[model samples]
Target: MSLPDDTRYLKGGPVAKRIMAEVARDAAKATAEGFPPKLVSITVGDVEAVGVYVRNQRAKAEQAGIGFEERNFPADLTAAELEAAIHGMNADPRVTGIIIQRPVPRHIPIKAIQAAVHPLKDVEGMHPASIGNIVYNELDLAPCTAAASVELLKETGLDLKGLEVVVVGHSEIVGKPIAFLLMSEGATVTVCHHMTRSVAAHARRADALFVAVGKPRLIKADMVKPGAAVIDIGINTETGPDGKERIVGDVDTDSVKEVASWITPVPGGVGPITVSILLRNTMVALARQRALYQATYGTAE
Candidate 1:
């Protein structure tokens, strides 16, 4: 079967605009009530991509009227030092949300450092508590990337319930969490990894597919099911002859787009939504904290 011409390509800019508008509205409400929303991000290393991502997030936060702060450390910092930084952010009342950028120095135990961040302030939803909440089907923050993937699919007017969904990759940050979230939404979920046998066979059966294996052009046209919704979370780069690197996603966009009914492009797709979802989580955290504060101290006049 050929791809449907009505297939929609999900764009992040409009969704980001909507999120920023909501944040502005909520910030106004918070300010009128005598409180201000804030988000804090902690980075341990000098990874260029991570730095660019943090800057983008800070820009988004500022646009949404939320205070943004970046705490950076040398790449050589020890795990203990990273944990300490997270602990400090956890204790800061003004900081409603905290995200410790990933791929921290190899020496650092990321899980231990993540656990150090207060679960309530873990806006990126990498904390164990957030994962537990997700498993239990409770209303809690999810890793922004995973949540953004689901939201992007939903916004396409597709119903996930009872769909055969295949997720390629098993990283805690994206793959596994997204499969869990999809299962929660009533989709039949399959989780695959690099070692998985007949990966293409699995993908070809998917009514919906999410690829986050971080390999460029990993999913070719033959592996995709016609009319399926494909979400490409992979961002891989290769240096060109001119000594400049170009970014591309796991699926061969030109080819896959011809087979899939709906797809998300690399730079313009999940990335923007991921950052927007971070802002959304921060706003949610702020609203929850504000409600609790008012319940204890009475609403501000």
Candidate 2:
């Protein structure tokens, strides 16, 4: 979708690059200090879409100077076996973080695997404790997408304090964490779900809006407040008149850009920043491990 001339396109390239540079520096330091940050990604079965995501993550990890490993298990692997493997990674001091790729065989419970990853080594921040930390305003290890969305909102240069924010979708990982994260920043956030009687009413009053309901073009221009910053976290595939599949965000970027001051493009927006945040979480986990090491051994190494 073509962006309007007057609207600021919230491209994520610059933000991801700036974060990667810092992570690279710290990654180098962590390596030199005998605590290299290594992320172990577990994938069950052969899923084409998940493969694409795994490759992107590995490339970003390489750019950030972090070690990445992909462990592909058989589709028949049981949940207990997967959890045991995750526990093994948790015990390895060289392993800094663990990421459980989504859509495992229907037999395997994804959340159980996520919980199996140690809280300290849960780089994806899907662990219950990792998500719970956001409630206390400790955002160091928040879910990558939620953290990335908040980071993009900050890039818009809007003062978060008392900002009227409306988040559509209340999923455990994305929507709930986003509301808590924004509230911690002092923004008055209203979350909309399937039960919300008037999603548009709350959305139109928002100074900053976040949408992640997985529905394409769910937020039209009329639903947005003028000059508000819109963060589109939903990634959906839609077939156009040409009979080809295309990616579009939850907000109709082509239409909403005319009214909104800033809007995030689907492919170039939150996805890239989300990957960068994952790498950043890896470093955060490494730092926490390093600090514990220092406290125990009286030396960083």
Candidate 3:
């Protein structure tokens, strides 16, 4: 869909590139300092959908000069056994971060696996402590998608201080964290969930709006404030009239772009930036680990 000249489409490539460049520089410095960052991915069972995500992560990690390792566990492995492996990685000084791939076999609880990863090594930011850090304004180790969405907002060059922001979605990973991060930046954030009385009413009053609900086209042009910056963090697959599958975001981009001053396009927006943010978190984890090592052994190693 072609965008109107009045609206600016926020592409993730340039932002991701800028961030990855910084990460690569930091990674190279860390490598020279003998504290290179390494990320370990834990995948349970065979999930075809997850394989694509893992490949992308590995490619981006390599670009950032970070080590990537994939550890595939048996589908039938008990949760306790999986947690033991995660604990082992937590205790391994070589492993800088841990990523738990989604859609593990129904038998194992995803949250349980996330909890097993130590907070210092939870680069994915799924751990409870990592999320809690955002509440206290410790923004370095936030969830990737949430951090990327905020990064895109900052790219608009609007002053976040005292800006009116509406977030349509309250999931722990995306919406809630985004609210906290923005508030930490001094933006007044209103979070709307399924039970909100009038999401559109709140959305239309914001200077900056973010939508992360799974429903496609949930935010129309009418729902957005004119000249507002819209960040669509939701990824949904929809089949067109011709039966071809396509990825889309929560906002109706074609229509919303006409109203919004800036908007992010699905498949080219937050996805790429999210991967870069993951690598950034890896460096943060590595820095924290290096501090601990220095305190304990009087050396970065």
Best by lDDT: 3
For every candidate in turn, the CA RMSD to the true structure comes to 3.2, 1.8, 1.7
Residue ranges of candidate 3 with Cα displaced over 4 Å: 299-301
Residue 286, candidate 3: Cα error in Å is 0.2
Clashes in predicted model 1? 0
Every candidate's lDDT:
0.84, 0.91, 0.94
Candidate 2 runs further than 4 Å off? 1-5, 299-301
* Residue pairs in clash, model 1: none
- Candidate 2 local lDDT, residue 95: 93
Q: How does model 1 fare in lDDT? A: 0.84
Best by TM-score: 3
- Candidate 2 lDDT: 0.91
The full ranking of all candidates by lDDT, starting with the best, is 3, 2, 1
Count clashing residue pairs in model 2.
0
Candidate 1 similarity to native, TM-score: 0.89
TM-score of 2: 0.96
Question: For residues 131-245, what per-residue lDDT tens digits would candidate 1 score against the true structure?
Answer: 9889988644799889888887777777888999999999997998998888888999999998998999999999889999988999999999988899999999988678999
Predicted candidate 3 versus true structure: per-residue lDDT over 1-301, tens digit per residue: 7777878988999999999999999999999999889999989989687989999999999988999999999999999999999999999999999999998999998898899999999999989999999899999999999999999999999999999999999999999999999999999999999999999899999999999999999999999989999999989999988899999999999889999999999989998899999999999999999988789989454
Can you write out model 2's per-residue Cα lDDT over 213-300, one digit (the tens) per residue? 9999999999999999999999999998899999989998888999999999888998889899999999999988877777988855
